[model samples]
Target: PYHSVAACAGLLRAGGFTELADGAQWKLARGGKYFVSKGGSEIMAFIVGGRFCQPGVESGLSIVGAHTDSPCLRLRPNSKVSGAGMLQVGIQTYGGGLWHTWFDRPLGLAGKVVVREAAPGRPDETRLAEKLVRITDPLMILPNLAIHLQSAEERKAFAVNPETHLQPVLCSKMFDDEAGKEASRPEDAGDARHHAALLEVVAKRLGCAPGDIMDADLCLMDSMPACLAGLYEEFISSPRIDNLLSTWAAVQGLCDFAASSAVADCQDVCIAVSFDHEECGSQSTCGADSNSMSVWLESLLGALEVPPLARPLVYAKSFLLSADCAHGVHPNYAAKHQSEHRPDFHKGIVIKTNANQRYATTALTSALFREVCKKADVPVQDFVVRNDSPCGTTIGPIVSSKLGIRTIDIGAPQWAMHSCRETCASSDARHLRALCGAFFESFRNIDTAAAKM
Candidate 1:
């Protein structure tokens, strides 16, 4: 997660956005237009006018919302703990996760930091925004209880509880034994004391003052890198592919669109945003539910100052593609997915459907996506949550309500979405990129009556 955010920030810098005071946060504007992407691959784009050219012309804000954060366990501040002569670091699951899959994997930590300097009452502040600090030396480990200690029923039914079992080993603390035995040192056993000690440890690692440490949001991720796996190398096994694949594809697509003139009259501003905290509900400043995108879009519109009628025209004409990830049916658990609705890897973009509208993809938007895919010569697939099951969500509906723009929820299908390592097809990345590019270039005046019909 930390590396992905840094990479995204670098991409945004390459596109010319000034980094905001808040470490990884950044913004860029051109004329009356704006484009923003957080940590870099997650993007949200905006435009001011073109309203007069189309009906219901209110605004021309075309949003493509994708999340930068994925499911993973975050190390707690006082994560270090010792048990029965063993040392471990406490971990809390950041989002809904596939808990059992996390056991026994090599893990690393990464996140942004606010460093403080020596000063009584007022510490000097320095933020290491996108700097990912990884402590890979057995920083944590969760050991499973032995089967011999449990009843047959207990052994047969295993459950993972984040408050306990997910903690990782941080190594021995025996070096402190002699110092503690030596004297005037008081016995330390409070959360605050532990937090202070950990903060000091972090400060020492960064060469900053212990007082300089402020607030931080960090997570422990699998030390494993994304790799091509399976027989014949047919799949990609990596951490956070649930949406990173879409984030990468969208960034690649936007870059491609910006460099091409093949699709003309294409002055609709381009944007790519990857907001933070999407794994949980998106209610933060950097989330879809917040004012970040809203404020940014309004500022871009004010800068553009399109003709009054053009605002409405832009809305009537504009579109949004909520690029998220979809679930590929597990062959072993095939009954959990609709047979006809299963999407194959490397095939193309997958149009997701949840009758409850858990997904923002509508009939009209899906058709539009299909048209774009057809025009781009990209193969496409469809996904529907099985009747007996409830599906997870994405950034689609949140952005739709926040911006009030037409949107189609789409993604590349993959397996084990919230696991420590997820899998997907290799070819879908390129195919999705092309489809997104085509959609961006082809967005213009659309027949609403025909669309509605």
Candidate 2:
């Protein structure tokens, strides 16, 4: 479960994308690829249209979006707490997840840490540092209450209090000597000395003084790495599969298109954007609700020397594919899904729809995606929640409304959505990559067809 935004930036850089700073002037080449990040969590990448500089033909944008965030336990600023002669780390749940599943799992910490950097002549400045600290030797566990101690009713209805039951015990009585030593350091006074041992471990790993650590946005993730599961090894069992799968698929698709000669000869710009905080509402500056995409588009057009009046025409012709994870019908709980609309694993990509606009897929846009899948020889499925069940949303509708561009919501089907571990078919992941590649390669023809209709 790799969750760091800085990590995503590294991958994009390796994929031949030149990073652009805010308000930086850049020249766009025919078939040029570039990317920009907001708060290092949300990222957007673009490929210039091959025919963008042609005389009279208008170029359209083919954009794909996914999110990189997942539900996990985040440590607070003052996270150290001692109880029952044991040192524990205080944690707050970040998003809605299967909390009980997190119990008794080998967890590791990963996220960016903010540190104070002081140079000789310059003023003190704060910088962000990232690290993936693994305490995988089973350092902490939220032990479950014994079943023998619970009533029959209580046993049937399992509940966990995040404030009380979720704290992870790191060690017992071993930190006393470290705490005493920390007390002698001037910067480690008061509550800071409480978790001196833990800070010392992190400081050592980061190669920084303990006092330079200002704060962190650390999250506890399952220590287990992604691997194939099932009798025939047909399923992928991993953490953050709900969205990281989509992010990976989108990146693979864009890279495939960029390497193809067909894409280099085309006139449509292709993009893949992965945002953070979609697990929570996307209200941050880097979120879909923000003007990050819009501003970037305008800048690109300006660099291409497109007239201001022609920008709206370019947007009107643009299309966005919002890829996220879709729920697969569980074998044991098939009845929980809509009777006729249950999406199955390994079948194909799922097209999500909601009349209430929870999903942005309309008849035209959904058909556009289906046509793309058909061209790629990929199977397609449909998913709509049961009438009695509440619908979940994605960045589809948010980006659609924000840019007023035609959009469709789609994803690879998966099981155990918010669990510490989730399941999906490896075949479906491959199919999504092909589908997105076909979309980026053939979107120009699709746009012309849709325009005629």
Best by TM-score: 2
TM per candidate: 0.83, 0.93
Per-residue alpha-carbon lDDT of model 2 for 173-243, expressed as tens digits? Answer: 65665557445566736438337777776777777877777777778878878899899999999999879
Model 1, poorest ten-residue lDDT window? 46-55
Best by lDDT: 2
Q: Tens digit of lDDT per residue, candidate 1, span 1-453?
A: 556656765665575444443233334333223345454323454332233223333224444557788888876765556676655666678888898888877776667665544445546644433234555444455567788888888777787767867777654456445433212223452223233345555666677654555556667777777788988887889988877888777766765665565324444665666676788898776677877776665545444555655555555555778888888778888878888998877778889888787888888888877877877899989999878887878778887776677777889888998888899888887787887667666654332334463
Name the runs in model 2 displaced over 4 angstroms.
Answer: 1-4, 118-137, 174-194, 451-453
What are the Cα lDDT values of the candidates? Answer: 0.66, 0.82
Worst 10 residues of 2 by lDDT: 130-139
As a whole number from 0 to 100, the lDDT of residue 335 in candidate 2 is 97
